[model samples]
Target: MLALAALLPLAGASFAQQKIEQQMSYEQFKAAGLDRLSPEQLANLNDWLDGKLKVETAKAAETAKQSGGDEDRRGLFLATSREPVDGTITGNFTGFGKGRSFTLDNGQVWQQIDDVSLTGVKDANPKVKITPSVIGSAWYLSIEGFNARAKVQRVK
Candidate 1:
């Protein structure tokens, strides 16, 4: 239900207008001079709205996937972003074993959510990528040339 609410904006203009109309109370509809619609006409209107809703939902999903705008990434934990981040880790590249935080050269600060040890690379200001998660506002940070990554939430 929450996802549907979030998706309403992606629905096309006509569908959005219909959705608003469908939500109107009977009295509201009458007040709007739409209560003159016969039973058959109302049924037909509802059928048309249902079909439009389905198409709009599918289109929104496809758009989200094609644009890397969905949550959970395409396959790995790493996300896709329109503006791919190319920056350096401001400090040593260690594992996120103890609530480690990453401060990028771009001035973005992200903290690891869990104790996921993403080791095997230790460098000062190593080039990395940070992409927005498809599902939520959370972001994923990864070390360059490495598969290790962590789901991070921006703090500063």
Candidate 2:
């Protein structure tokens, strides 16, 4: 029992580290093949990536909305390359100006804007400002451009 206890923390830490590494590796793998992700995988990845984008966009929008009349009109926009490569970047843009709002899934609202465009990147460290739009009805997200647009709605 003592030996087991001694190893438990190490085991847990290793497991946690492995999970993080796996997630990173999976992201890398996906980014490397932006043109060739399986439909299912692509769908899943887009959903995941969009979820993160929504949170950041919403925060920026809320801040801008609250910054009074003196606030800048530019909105924030962010985009990440669906490529799998090491040291790849996740692109981001701030101050995108105003955009249009729409309904998404699950009684959620989103604002859509066409502000910035980025490609061949992976992760974004700095938060960006862009347009926010609804994802079906339940969630709000950001859409960066026309060609790089990703339409994601709820599943049933």
Best by TM-score: 1
How good is model 2 by TM-score?
0.26
lDDT of 2: 0.32
Residue-level lDDT tens digits of model 1 in 71-124: 323222222322445678887886655467787786767778856676665677
Question: Distance (Å) between predicted and true CA of 47, model 2?
Answer: 0.7
37-130 per-residue lDDT for model 2 (tens digits): 5667656655654554455445544554465422221111211111111111134333223353333222323344344443454434322222
Error of 2 at 150 (Å): 22
Model 1 is weakest, by summed lDDT over 10 consecutive residues, at: 72-81
Q: What local lDDT does model 2 show for residue 135?
A: 20
